[model samples]
Target: LAQRSKAKDWTRLIYSTALSPHQIVRGEPNAADREKDEENDDDFFTLKKATDVDADSMDATKETYPSDQLTKWDNEEMFDSIRNLFITGRNDP
Candidate 1:
């Protein structure tokens, strides 16, 4: 039937449009093209590289705590509590 053939044609069009590459669908330049343009424009910008002195100052300023001073949780117990709450639909275990 003509209606069935039209439905099939529309289905094919929808699928092909969905599955096609983004650039093809949108008629835009792909990532490779943009990357090529970026490569060409790299000379226009100046990038600052971190010096050894900066790195050393950053490392010297960090504070560290002892392992025993940090709060610890039993992961298995926490997971079981959460699972029970979800299964029972109750806030308290």
Candidate 2:
């Protein structure tokens, strides 16, 4: 879950940087982008360092599961997985 969250954060960051005002105005990332990039660089390094610690902590807390098990899931299981992906408690309205 932590890794998934990080991946989502990275996706958001990339899209945000790609669509920033400087990129729209200059048709390319430039000096203004550099400022935001520097901030993201700091975040990257911080996330990298934290990942090392998180990896160790997660290993101690989470149970190991076989990756191949997903491939063996039945139709019902696959449907449940797809449903879970599209429907979350947070999106309820």
Error of 1 at 67 (Å): 73
TM-score of the candidate numbered 2?
0.18
**Model 2 stretches astray by more than 4 angstroms:** 1-26, 44-93
Tens-digit lDDT string for candidate 2 (1-93): 455454444455556665654334334455875686568775644443222133345436666778776555666756565553464623433
Q: Evaluated with lDDT, which candidate comes out highest?
A: 1
Q: Each candidate's lDDT (Cα)?
A: 0.54, 0.52
Identify the leading candidate in terms of TM-score.
1
lDDT of 1: 0.54
Per-residue lDDT tens digits of candidate 1, residues 1-93? 455454444455556665444334344456886687677666866455333254445535677877653433455565565564576656666
lDDT of 2: 0.52
Model 1 sits at a Cα RMSD from the real structure of: 17.9
Worst 10 residues of 1 by lDDT: 19-28
